[model samples]
Target: MSNLTWQIGCVRVTRIEETLTTIPLTSFFAAATPEALAPHLPWLRPHFVDAQDHAILSIHGLVVESQGRTILVDTCIGENWPESNPLERSALLGDPTSPFLGNLERAGFQRERIDVVLCTHLHFDHVGCNTMRVDDTVVPTFPNARYLFARTEWEHWRAQEDPGFAATLRETVEPILAAGLADLVECDHVVTDEVRLEPTPGHTPGHVSVRIASQGKEALVTGDMAHHPVQWAEPTWGIAADSDGAQATRTRQRILAQHTDDDLLIIGTHYAPPTAGRLVRRDGRVRFASG
Candidate 1:
């Protein structure tokens, strides 16, 4: 994992990159074909997207430092731990060895010192590192911290008919609950003066985005609210992973409408390197502008 960190006023956000990979644009965005992405090539190339139209995605977690507390936003795929489904598996490289714990300590964060763990949603990838294997059993990675989960998010995945998602709930989430370490919270619950969880559903029934404001500066940690930056270029474009496309579009619109400027720093959980940037209104449409 790469130690890429950014600061937003009094709060500092660091990217504990799990893995960086690419997938075809056609396969990534449901409404976009390779042909449709052609026009946006000049702006997208060599950074967000590549020559073959693959969208670059980084699976990682964000460490939010504020108010003398260390909070981990999302945990990435495990260090030596493997996953069952394709979604979780693809985020890994062959014999993936991104020593998650080693990297965390190297970044000056002690696992046992993490005050809280916030999962934006209960997708397999986002919650993979919630627990780490200990010889024969899986256990909560951060033994001394409280894990914050959205109540609706927990029930949504637990009742999923898809076995893959169900397996995810069993593997990644149940362990936390079993340990008496989870604190199921509502979507609008506040974490701190600078960090708050706000519903941005659509990717899932209870999806959320984190809002951070400090000293007149602001930032939004977008948890899959919009996967690729290209979506800002074409709002209609979307991904198949979304459980509710219409709702997701509305949520994406809401984000772009509010923060398409420098005043709000938009931090993407899955965007490639230099992942944190801002959006802008260009020719009546929202566009991804460097932050």
Candidate 2:
């Protein structure tokens, strides 16, 4: 766990890390190449990029404490990987060891105390912790939390014939739905006065970024709209998993333009350490200024 936290007026958000590793730029980004990334390497190194120039990716969940409610953002890859999906397991969790739950409890966020489990999308990494293996059956990890899923996201993945996604749906989401603890919500559903969902599609249909507003302060929890800070410089670069690369680029461009030179904190879902920053114009390009 990075033990990183941010305050947005009346809301406090903490990062509960599950895994942190580097991925080859070519493997993670479609347009990322050594020559193409050379210009931004100065600011990207030491945090976003490693000595080998690989992208540093963090798999973690944000614990949002707002209005006396504890709302968990995206759940990272869980402890147990479905045996039926060896490809997904090997791709997502090559090591299979996870410290997510322990980190949450250490941070004072008990499983039973969680008021909501809000997933931005139904991807394997984002929704893997929705359930846990108990004996021979899978069950909801947060027994008392109401798992919230975007109706469109749920329907989209529910109809997916892809084996990896189907396995994820079976092991993580279906158990919660069967237990009657799931709630299908719109993309822009409000979780609280200080916290709400902002529809930022294209990474996946029905994908949403979380918006927090309180005491005149604001922040946006980007759910893969832009994976790395380099995207602020080149919005056209997208990950391989993107359903619509052009739409994802457009969303990034619109949001970056809207928040450029503004005070709104940009909390990236897959960013490395010092993950939150503000967008600003520098050298005729949008840059992420991490504090």
Report lDDT (CA) for all predictions. Answer: 0.81, 0.89
For model 2, residues 149-225, the per-residue Cα lDDT tens digits are: 99999999899898778888889999999999999999999999899999999999989999999999999999889
| RMSD value for candidate 2 | 1.3
Where does candidate 2 clash, by residue pair? none
Q: Per-candidate TM vs. native? A: 0.93, 0.97
Per-residue CA lDDT of model 1 for 59-165, tens digit only, reads 87899988987899888766424355754564453345555567778888888989899999987668878887789788898999889999989888888788788
Q: Give the true-structure RMSD of model 1.
A: 2.0
Supply every candidate's count of residue pairs whose N, Cα or C atoms clash at under 3 angstroms. Answer: 0, 0
